[model samples]
Target: MKLQGKTAIITGAAKGIGAATARLFAFEGARLLLLDKDEANGAAVAASIAERGGKAVFRRCDVGCEADVRAALDTVVDVYGDLDIVVNNAGWQLNKSLLETTAEEFNAVLNTNLTSMFLFTKGAAELFIARKKGGAIVNVCSTFAVVGSPGYAAYHASKGGVASFTRAAAISLMPHNIRVNAVGPGTTDTPGLHDGARDTGDEDQGMKSFLALQPLGRFGKPEEIASVIAFLAGDEAGFVTGALWMADGGYTIV
Candidate 1:
């Protein structure tokens, strides 16, 4: 019940880490707002939360769109009266070489993964400042932000941007008591990952490659990552800001 009575918004909440975070936040007593482009699954997650006795609502949003981000937060404040936490968890990945990545593809990936963070942060910070009540923003980053790989040029760039932007945003918003931080997760078992693998046309190989990178010899669970996010959002992390909390299972150590 660390987040009892708090209001939270989680983008890309239809499934995977976003879904797990929604469930966990609900259990902790936070009023939930789940956002995703997938209309069906997003609504389903909200319905599931209600069944579990948590207050939740779902909104279909393209996080990369400013209008959508604004509207989503507006709806949250309208329904819940205020906003306390926001988790920028929506993202897209591109497993392509730099030479093969088209300009449009790169732009789209950046818009989805990096620019979306900008939109959410700006939108939520405005509300937080106006309310005169500081809020928390937990960004979902990746170990790829720190590590280098052959393919996924755009994804690496976007994630790296997120890592740096999180710190800059944290410093800029400190005066308002609005905290910004990031969680860098290693490869996790999520629908998104599976989908990404399918997109690559080699699901098993993609998974094997990911597993090989983890010293733990296994993938991470959405619930495990969600726990970290919950801690950062709650009062326990009041003093922590501008930090990159890595939930990577020793992925960056080597």
Candidate 2:
């Protein structure tokens, strides 16, 4: 149990990569605080963890809302006494070319993908500083953060912000023993991906297009990404900070 007795808060943990990470962290002996806007799904994931003999609690949180995020973090710290790890994994995708993207749409993507990271980092850093115990923060980025995609201008920009923010935050927090890092995953098979495909009205084509870009000829699994995140949050990665760890299955190689 690499994370035995640690307390972790994972955002967007109702399903997909966030959910997978929550399960893995629980198994590794972390008391889990899972947050998602979907109450039913979040509660279901928490219930499953408890059934497996792991400790967990679920809360409905819209990470984009500052008040909601603040209250949620306060609740976690109050319940667990200390916060050891925070994973900023809540995000959404909008497939729109730059020309077709509206201001509202662009803001929406930024708020969820980038702004939420800022809010959580701010809130968590305060807690860590107050406790005088350094903690780890893992921001979920995308391969697109480094590579440009035609129809993902907003998403790319937002994730790029995450990558940059991760580096800056890491440097600033190093003196406090806080480590800030990010994981850039390639296209993974998650509920969010499926939903994006459906929104494009070409689920099959969308999936095929994603597969074609991957050197592995297949999309990644949520657990694969979760594994990298778990490593980053563990003591094994103590010396690593201000880094963007890529798990793109060679998608960025080309």
Candidate 3:
């Protein structure tokens, strides 16, 4: 019960790492607000948690939109009475080279993958600072932030920006007892990865290549990444902040 009695908002909770985090947090006794653009999946995840005797509410939200971000935070306050943690797990990626990527595509990826962090932190902090309560923020980044990869120009830029933003936000919010950190995951077996594989025209080949890159000789599971997020959000991470944790199975080490 690491998060017992705490209220947490998990954006992108419809599936993948976000959904996994929601389940683990719920199991650890958190009151959850699951936010996602995928309304159906988000609701299903929340309902599944409820069916298991955990408390959760699903809200449809576009993390990149300022109004949506505000409304989601407002819902958290109105429904849960207080906010203890936020997992900014929403992200978008397009596997295209700079020459092939359109300006619109670049901006859209940046808005969803990077700017949403600014919005969530700013919006949620208003309530946290006002109520004089401390909180934790966990941003989902990617190993691409540190290691250069062919294609995905915008994705790389956005994730690199997230890592930098995490550090800056942590330093700025420290006085208020807000701990901001990031989790950089390697090639994980998420729906997004499958989608990326399809886009590249070979799911099996992509998986094999990805697995070969990992020192663990396998892909990461969503639950593995979520476990780290759970740890960072809990009381055990009280003394930790401004850190970028690699949950990538040593993918970056090689």
| Number of the top lDDT candidate | 1
For residue 236, give model 1's deviation from the true position in Å.
Answer: 0.2
TM-score of 3: 0.98
- lDDT of candidate 2 over 34-104, digit per residue (tens): 99999999999999999999999999999999999999898997889889899999999898899999999
Candidate 2: Cα lDDT at 22 = 97
Error of 3 at 24 (Å): 0.3
Which digits, one per residue and each the tens of the lDDT, describe model 3 over residues 77-177?
Answer: 89989999999999977989989999999999999999999999988777789988899999999999999877999999999999999999999999999
- Error (Å) of candidate 2 at residue 43 is 0.7
Clashing pairs in 2: none
TM-score of candidate 2 relative to the true fold = 0.98
User: Each model's TM-score?
Assistant: 0.98, 0.98, 0.98
Candidate 1 lDDT score at position 123: 89
lDDT of 3: 0.93
Model 1 lDDT, full chain set: 0.94
By lDDT, rank the candidates, best first: 1, 2, 3
Ten contiguous residues minimizing lDDT sum, candidate 3: 205-214
